[model samples]
Target: MAVPETNKVMRLLEGRHWELREGPFKRLGEGADQRLREIADNTSLTNYLRFRALIALSLYDNEETGVHLERHARSGIRPLPAEGFHP
Candidate 1:
């Protein structure tokens, strides 16, 4: 998802305004972790899209995913979700 083509696609498809979560493609399972990481790390993508990738990663309950969200918050990408919101 960090690739230029994917970045361009994101640019073309990002929402005009914030909307509630409609969710990303699911059923990808753990194999998608690395791609999601790339998506979350791609600064070219809007925070909204990157944030969706991060939220997908958050489902794994992995420490690194947590770190990504924290870093994003500190970097002003977006605020970290409140605790227990998804539990």
Candidate 2:
């Protein structure tokens, strides 16, 4: 997705203004982890999206997600574009 569109989604997610009709994990089941892994692994995506996916995985509180989050934290990678919002 384009940066603007991705940013819009991020805002909705972060703002808690959007509700999942079906919980993502429930809807995707085991595939949720796979999808998160794919998003986390894809370097082409904005850091905001990748980080958000990582955070979502962490929220699931699974061992794998914890490991991934730990690795990501240790990497010290900063989000691209620096700032997420503009007035």
Candidate 3:
């Protein structure tokens, strides 16, 4: 079973309140970037949650996050990594 905190993080990631305000590759501002980074670095979160965080970061044009997602995909994980997703 997933931990409560991890569930909460996942919920937050999917929640409308935190939805990306712009198109992919658009900057989400510093606050949003920091929040995504926080979620990405949180070891307590499930890999799925971490993946979502990385996706969110990618939408903000974070290249490093895209690379991390690619690595996860190469490892053959679920939710399969996105391809050709620059930004």
Model 2 agreement with the true structure over 1-87: per-residue lDDT tens digits = 112233333343343343333354444445465466567668886666665666566545678777776777787666433545211
Best TM-score among the predictions, by candidate number: 2
**Worst lDDT 10-window in candidate 1:** 78-87
* lDDT of each residue in 33-67, candidate 3, tens digit only: 55666777666765555656776665555565566
Give all candidates' CA lDDT scores: 0.53, 0.53, 0.53
Candidate 2: where is the Cα deviation over 4 Å? 1-22, 79-87
What is the Å distance of residue 4 in model 3 from its true position? 20
RMSD of each: 7.7, 7.2, 9.2
lDDT of 1 by residue, 1-87 (tens): 332334443442256563433233233334455566777787675556766666556555567667766677678433524321121
Better of 1 and 2 by TM-score: 2
Find the number of clashing residue pairs for candidate 3: 0
Estimate the TM-score of every prediction. 0.47, 0.56, 0.42
**Superposition error at 2 for model 1 (Å):** 18
Residue 45 displacement in candidate 3 (angstroms)? 0.8
For model 3, give the 10-residue run with minimal summed lDDT. Answer: 78-87
